[model samples]
Target chain A: MSMGSEKKAKRVRIAPFITILFFLIMGIVGIMTGEVRRVLEQAVQVCLSCIGIG
Target chain B: MEIVRKWIQTIMALLVNGSWSFPFTRTIYQGPLKVVCSPGLNCYSCPASTTYCPIGSLQQLMAGIRIAIENGQNFFGLYVVGTMGVLGGVFGRLICGWACPFGLIQELLHKIPSRKFSIPQKLNYIKYGFLLFFVFLLPLTVVDKFGYGELWFCKYVCPAGTLEAGLPMLMLQPALGQTIGLVFFNKLAILVGFILWSILASRPFCRTTCPLGAFYALFKKLKLVKLRHIEENCTRCEACHSVCPMGVKFNESPENAECISCLKCMDKACKFDAITLEIAGLPMGSRAGARIHRPKQGEVSM
Candidate 1:
């Protein structure tokens, strides 16, 4: 393969791995920070009530 | 297959927002299922919604973190973000094409007999701006009198919220009429505009301004299930491009972020079996009698 094409292939291969890794790190941080529980607390309620309609 | 997918989307829509009496009760579903994240742009405020809206949860996370920072506390929400990332990595925008109730509504609207118009391809980038500004920046930065940041996208721009949650709330509880203000009317106007626009164009919201759709688009290249182009068999047929609702030139960029994995470009459009759905690198279905080979010039003459 040409150098340019090989470089493109390498980038494509590496992108997903990097993204997955970043997500894994963030997920761990979120759990450690108690963010997951916070989200759960917020999720377990119903407040919109057509008040803001948002 | 498309029909089957449509049915699944409809079923999911019904299943996720299945609380019928919540409208009269004026209470959102507080079931255990609420802890889960909806894979699409569903409004958590909707009485029937069984799960949290990922975009709304993300904005809440940012707002909470900002509040926490102000209070000298370290706080962040991982569940919503993690769920979104995992879902995006696995399915990409397949939710937009196949599972989103709002996307389904737009598709139905586009089917109305009207003079359809194609948007400029460049407009697709606008969703990224919406994602950066409305979903992230504004929600995290803009503060209320109590130093609380509002969910700007949900409060100001989300037509899905207005349609699913707002309308139903008002209809179910006439008492909310007294509290209806200018902001509600403005949102109503926006919803009407989207409804009208959806009729004239295909998936206009998904193409131009859905922050959640934009988020999923980022993971398009990384998703496990994807459309693969069989370059060897391709006859340069532009059928895939023509059928693509998102106007993706699948022949050139099969993994285009705009692609929703609707598979319309597969069985029907690509006559030479050029495009097929694959998990990892392996094709996922029967190949027998599926291909439509276009005859060569010599064969056509003969």
Candidate 2:
């Protein structure tokens, strides 16, 4: 591969780290804002729609 | 490697749906683990499930976003989005190939001795529509008198929900049969259709319908772990195409959005070192180094 292509490949490889870091920050904010608890409340109940009963 | 992948998939399916007590109790698991989201498309309503389905949880959040905003509650669903994002970034559609219970079921169903068919490539784009409409747009836009939206995907489309939760729940508690209506029958029809299609085609739902798989496909080009196609080493032999469950032609586009990273191309089909498993652009191992012995013809490599 050419040097330019190699550089592009490096950038592509780095993209996942950046994406993961951004989402991880958002996840921490969600947890701090009590999103986990909300999700838990929703999940604990048998979702009627999920069981095709709604 | 195929055997190893199958074992991992089976173990993952069992581990996520680990509430074995459901058979005797006839009730869904409400353990603390339900708070965690499984990476695959297993249903939270499944009696034996220990974790939530991200797509279902996402729909729940989307459907209630209006009410949440009016009530001054957080409605971003950042945690679920982040969870999905992190998993997708790390593995991409490898979860579909190796972890998803529904994907495993489809693969096993396809294994039943029968004539197989290929899905139209254009249909692959339909999943993005399902992700946009059923998972997000419909739920967020359409609301009831109370300003609460419905779980559109789970209620109308998800065969996983029907197979894992609906059928079992109805069988376990026959009293719930009174509640069955057109919607239940509709979902059952979709489930039956997909089951039959799975036998006829490989992973038809994952290829054409799954919103979660669509979400993961967004990260295919940038996922940390990926199959790197070595163009110079390739001989234009279309062996990889024949073995791909997701129908990815690796040489033409190494980063095809449809690829599930199942490693069938790398581990089973490639005679040349055209494909290599990579982590962050670094080649972890070659295909030859990974396989001890190759399966013979008609031996069920998948």
Candidate 3:
């Protein structure tokens, strides 16, 4: 492969870890900010919209 | 390998929907597990689902965004997005291939031994529209007198929700049947339509309509676990295309967005070992790699 193509391959290989890291940090922040509680509150109840009753 | 995949699909389905006490209690599971999101499109309102459906929770958050802002609270659904992102970054559509109960249902429906058909390639773009409009734009923009938006996708579309939650809940609490109106019928019609389409075409919803699948497809090129095609080993036999349930031509484009990394091509079809499963640039295994010790003919008398 040429230098440019090799560099592009390296970026492709590294992109997932970067994406994973960013999301993992966001997820941890969300948990600390009570987003889990929000999801729980909504999910625990029978969502009328989901059942098409809304 | 196919049997193993089927077993995994069955086990994951049961594991996520593990709240088996619903029949006796006549209610959905309301446990702490609901805080976590399942990787697939299983409905949180499903009687036995112990985990939240990411798409449903996302729409709920988007719908409540204005209310949250008015109350001086920031609610971007970071947790839900992050969870989905992490899964997508790691597995891409592998979850759809191996873990999603809805995807499994479609596969089973397609196996009913009828005339199978291929989905139009143009239709694949529709899921992106669903993701953008129903999941994000509508839920965030269209509001009622209370400044609260509606869960447009869940209320109007989402055949998985109808099949997993609506039909079962109605069956369980027949009294709730009276509340059913045009919206319910509309959703039921969509569910029925998708069901018949799934029978005729492999994973029609996944290919053409699932918002979750669209979200994950964004990570196809970046996912850690994926199928890689070695061009040097390929004989251009076109066998992979024939076996792909999602109709992905792996040898030609291993990183195709429609690929679910189910490994059907790698495990069953590729004769020259052109395809291999990779995790973080390392080869996990390949079909030819596994057949190196096969017993020769007439040499199996142990």
Tens-place lDDT digits, model 3, residues B2-92: 8999999999999889999988999999989898789999999999999999999999999999898888767888999999999999999
Among residues 3 or more apart in sequence or in different chains, the pairs in candidate 2 whose N, CA or C atoms overlap within 3 Å are none
Best by TM-score: 2
TM-score of chain A considered alone, across all candidate predictions? 0.63, 0.69, 0.68
For model 1, the superposed segments whose C-alpha errors exceed 4 Å read A1-18, A21-25, A49-54, B70-73, B285-288, B292-302
Clashes of each: 1, 0, 0
Q: Tens digit of lDDT per residue, candidate 1, span A1-54?
A: 367644543343444555666777777787777766676677666556322642
At residue B8, give the lDDT of candidate 3.
96
RMSD per model, one decimal? 3.9, 4.5, 5.0
What does candidate 2's lDDT look like per residue over B4-87, in tens digits? 999999999999999989878897998899888899999998999999889998999999988888888986789999899999
In model 2, which regions exceed 4 Å deviation? A1-12, B289-302
lDDT for residue B7 in candidate 1, whole number 0-100: 98
Residue B122's lDDT within candidate 2 is 99
Which segments of candidate 3 are over 4 A away from where they belong? Answer: A1-12, B288-302
lDDT of 1 at B172: 74
